[model samples]
Target: MKEKIEQALFEVRPYIEYYEELKKRVEEIASTTDEEGLFIKLLEEEIKKSEEPFKTDLRIFLQKFTSFL
Candidate 1:
C-alpha cells in the first residue's frame, strides 16, 4: 500500500512541482490532515479545473491511487 501510494505520488510529482496552487494544496493537506481520501478529493477537484495533459495525468494518478483504497 505504501509502495502504491509512493508510485502515485511519483506520477504526480512533476505536476505538483510545476503548479504553485497544487504544490501549496498538497503541502497544506500534508500538514493539516492524515486522511488520504481528503487529499485525493482535493486533488480531483483541482484536476477538474486544470487543462489538457495535466488534467489527464492527474486523473490517471487519482485512478491509480484510489485503486489501492
Candidate 2:
C-alpha cells in the first residue's frame, strides 16, 4: 500500500504543485475584502477538482494533508 501510494503521489506531483500554487493565490485573495466572493468561488472550484480522486475518504485525506503541512 505504501508503494502504491508513492507511485500515485509521483503521478500526481504536478497536480499537487498546481494545487499548492492555487492555494497560495487563494490566500492572497482571501486577504482582500473586495474579492471575498471570488476567493470562495476559487476555493470551491479547487475543492471540486480535488474531490474526484478523493471521493473514497475525503476526511481522511484532509487530515493527512493537514498533518503533512
Candidate 3:
C-alpha cells in the first residue's frame, strides 16, 4: 500500500510541480481534508485532464488508499 501510494505520488509529481493550480489544489486539499478523501477528490478532478496510465494509476491508487481509510 505504501509502495502503491508512493508510485502514485511519483506519477503525479511532475504535473503538480509544473502546474501552480494543481499544486495549490493539492495543498488546499491537504490542509482541509483527510489524506484518502483528499487524493480521491483531487484524482477525480485530475483524471479528466490526464491521459492513459496515469489516469488508471490514479484510480487504482484511490481505490487502494480508500481501503486503508
Candidate 4:
C-alpha cells in the first residue's frame, strides 16, 4: 500500500501543488494500521465540507490518487 501511494504520488503530486497535507496524511496512513479507516473517513468528511475549487481539487486528487489502491 505504501508503495502504491508513493507511485501515485510521483505521478500526481506535480499536478497538485497544494498537496503537502495530503502527503502527510499518506505518511500517517503508511506508518500505522488504521483498522477503522478513520483517516479516510475524515478525509471524506472534509471533502464534503470543503468549498469549491479546493473541494473539487481534493476530490480529483483522491480519485486519481486512489486509482492504484
Top candidate (lDDT): 1
> What's the lDDT of the predicted structure labeled candidate 2?
0.42
By TM-score, who's the top model here?
1
RMSD after Cα superposition, model 3: 6.1
Ranking by lDDT: 1, 4, 3, 2
Q: How close is candidate 1 to the true structure, as a TM-score?
A: 0.60
Check candidate 4 and list the clashing pairs: none
lDDT of 4 by residue, 1-69 (tens): 556667776777776646776677556655665433554566577688877756765676667656755
Candidate-wise lDDT, in order: 0.65, 0.42, 0.55, 0.64
In model 3, the runs with Cα more than 4 Å from the true position are 1-36
TM-score of each: 0.60, 0.29, 0.45, 0.56
lDDT of 2 by residue, 1-68 (tens): 23333343344445453444433544454455344345445445556665444432333333333343
**Candidate 3, after superposition: displacement of residue 21 in Å?**
17
Instruction: State the lDDT of candidate 1 residue by residue for 13-69, as single tens digits.
Output: 665534544445446645655688777777778787878756765676677688878
Pick by TM-score: 1 or 4, better one: 1
Candidate 2, residue 67: Cα displacement in angstroms equals 22
